[model samples]
Target: MTVHPDRLDELVRAARAGGVRGVGRRSFLRGASVSALAVGVPGLLAACGTESQVQTAESCTSEDRSAAEKALVFSNWPEYIDRKGKKMPTLEEFQTTSGISVTYNTDINDNTEFFGKVKDQLGGCEPIGRDIITMTDWMAARMVALGWVQELDMGAMPHVEANLKSDLRSPTWDPDRSYSVPWQSGLTGIAYNAKYTGEVGSFEELMTRSDLKGKVSLLSEMGDTMLFMLLLEGADPEDFTEEQWSGALGRLEGYVGSGQIRRFTGNDYIRDLNAGNVVACEAWSGDVIAMQYDNPDIKWVVPEEGLSLWSDNMLVPNKAEHKANAEALMDFYYQPEIAAQLAAWVNYICPVEGAQEAMEQVDPSLVDNPLIFPDEDFLANAYGFMELDESTRQQYDKDFARVIGA
Candidate 1:
């Protein structure tokens, strides 16, 4: 999920509040901001006065010490794994089975913040001390573009080759799936508190309905929020033009200017939605699914325009010493049993093809949950954002931040 600022302090506090695990499983403590989370190091490029900071194996040599080290350093978002009493069942199982000790860190609260912490090291082809880092699509793409991440040995990951879902196999940035592996995937859709209003079926209704005016919050993430705008304009988000982008941005600007939209929010929208302070809003599917467990008033809808699909990918940064061990870990998780266990706890879309049947043995309750294992028809209308070059991505992000008042 994308995050935002203003409530950043709250985001930090929430991210660090509880002991090791931070918040509850599926808790809403995302820490992304529109401007800050826009693109990977746009501000850094401007500050460093660099045209590009690209690398390759020839330019930045890497070594695989997995045979000797037998250790890995991984970083991921808080409360993202399956946990019970401070122990991650799936992770512990991996360690026990693979014998690869992992130094798992939950330090990635926001994509931008994490990027800031590592951009300096990555740009200079130095080690960021991370074997596997989980980040949303845009950040992953940026790292891949700059060649800051290592290419995976797919030959070692047979499970991934056989079980990875078709839609997730070829992201534009990593079309051949050489560098990044998805940790988890999720969808962006509309959510309305039934206690506050009737079912809100479409994005258009969320924006233009009179009674919902000033009570609807759009997502702060550019791609998640703008994909629908692109769809509403009869344009394909996966391959839109500069003209299409401009038209979509202008339409969103009109909604914001007319006071039809309440505010642009990150995961913090969960609080406003729960309190009924905001009736209907653009929301993440996983967040809405988790909310429904406690508050039946929350309802998620696949907007008429369609859904925005994104994934938090697993990447091994350049200079990570445990390349083979990291590859081992990636392959281990792709096993249908392990993937189902993770999906049962995280409640996001499972990217493994055979995980649905595996869920019958892991957790029968989740066997039929669409959010966890959506069928082909459910995802037919789902769309991903168009890939952009760094400069163009930075420009679109700047434009998006301006419209969202970030």
Candidate 2:
């Protein structure tokens, strides 16, 4: 379903007037309030599920439902989910067992644009016109702070509560997970074409080596690239302050200004790296996996300095029309067997604990891949990006635009 531009703006205006200070606070309150209202409205709950069922984290009984009945409206990135000629069994099972239908859509291509579209409405009491959305951890944190998401019902998601990675829980963004649930986790590291880079061993080798100057690319996004730079500079991302960020930005500006740097990129880095047009660039761990499928020579490395551990989470929007169904779907995905299928297909880090073993049952070869199941040693070198305050985010964005624009 498309979010009308005008309507989204109207909602944003309403939310702005409702004393919502930021995107997170606004979206959370708006989603919760709207869901609460919809639950109270006669016939609304009945239309979605049994009137007396009272859907909560603890109440989603997966029985006597059809695949089509558990229809969920999910918004995600393009090509992110598994499909076989239009069939999604994992989602289909939710429909069959819980009697909930899922209308999955992939309309979110950019995070900033998506936030801008719904910021207003979520600030108010209206549903943000979406049941669920998947976005990066940093953006999720922003939405959580604005109150644009619903606190997950852990009781309903026992599988998730039990299986989710320890590090992913109690994040600084949503200390108690009052707003979001991690859909997948991955690392930000160096992806290089071995043929072009000639035995590149570290991040510094790509950035500082004279031979590789003008051949390397870095992520244009502030969070992904800057955090990597901070780690290289020996700054602790988890404990960094505004002063440290300023220092990181300054160093990044120098790299950008010099002719030593190539272009900044996003997913295009994958294409460029695969084609040997770019030797090394900052890349998501999952994208690297996809690239490797085509070019075995491509190498993804977590620098000796360390790398960023990132998670993109699923959230129920404030203006969601089907919160109960949405919550049920969330809980359903948390199941180990179900989550394994998604992780195997998507090739991201599974949040569910036993998902790796479940995936091994499906395909034994996948169990040993570090990218899919990061080991303790590798994880020891990973750090989640720290949350930036509004002012810092604004400044960082400005600097990022300058680098990309130049």
Candidate 3:
């Protein structure tokens, strides 16, 4: 989920109430005018800096405090961890067993926003006061690219190596899995109120259908919505050229121009969707899965083009005082039993390989759920967005913000 800039974590409660859950493009318009986006988005990005231009923290290091500190702060999305009335069972057990004090903060409501908060401290080779921060693929890549994150000691994370799902093993940004490890995987696809809009099987229909016009929303995340637009334009998001990005951006501009898109949003689309104020929109598979438990009108569909596959990654920020303890926690969660336990409650794609078998003991029904345990068919249609270079990411962010009038 992208997020509301001011009250970024406001959607966190909504995400937890249902379940744990949890783009683009380029230029050529260099010759053209981006009056609205150029005008409206100047301040929207006050929270985020130019990611590509962020200074690399080549000198960042923290003292070995783990032996005595014996504590770490983990910032993850809201509702991502399992809770039993003020207690996160797995985390509590980890602290008890390992004798590590853990401070868990759910303040990471959006990738760009969180980066904005910590960039200054990180760039100065200082601490952002956290040991770990879990973020989506693109932002994780940006942090890794900028050297804002610390490298993991894979030797200490043997379970991560053995149990990490094959598909999530490598991201172009962290090709060697040195800086980032996936926390959970999810699919971004077409979601709609079946009772209102029928089947929105493609982005084209969602952006053009008469009934959906003025009643539809799209994700605020550039990668999620813009990559879908890239696919809608018959381009591969995993690898595409700037010319391809320009075409997709133009198409998106047209959607907003038509007023077919009521607003660009993060997970808050679910609220409007449930109220029927929105008939259809882009959505994440997990959010739809949680919504369906109460309302049958909710539907999730992989577009004819495919599903956008992404992961929220666990990364140790540079200068973290308890890197070793943080490594211990990461390793603990990688254990299939622990991963499956977290997955059962959150209902997102689990990143552990043996978690499916582990889920059998937890919930036999989830074993066959493609959303939880994706089969070959689901894999066939899932696509990951291309990892953008720094310059490209900076430009694309501006372009996407402009189009969404953020």
Q: What is the TM-score of each candidate against the true structure?
A: 0.83, 0.77, 0.84
lDDT of each: 0.88, 0.75, 0.84
lDDT of 2 by residue, 254-295 (tens): 776776678876556777887777887777888777767778
Model 2 Cα displacement at 302 (Å)?
1.6
Q: What does the lDDT read for residue 48 in candidate 2?
A: 77
Question: Tens digit of lDDT per residue, candidate 3, span 171-282?
Answer: 6778789888888999988888877768888887888888787999888889998888998888999889889999999999988998898987766788999989998888
Model 2: lowest-lDDT 10 consecutive positions: 57-66
lDDT of 2 at 142: 78
What is the TM-score of candidate 2? Answer: 0.77
Give the C-alpha lDDT of model 2: 0.75
State the displacement of the C-alpha of residue 271, model 1, in Å, after optimal TM-score superposition.
Answer: 2.7
Who is ahead in TM-score, 2 or 3?
A: 3
Off by over 4 Å in 2: 1-70, 124-126
Tens digit of per-residue lDDT, candidate 1, span 226-247? 9999998899999998899999
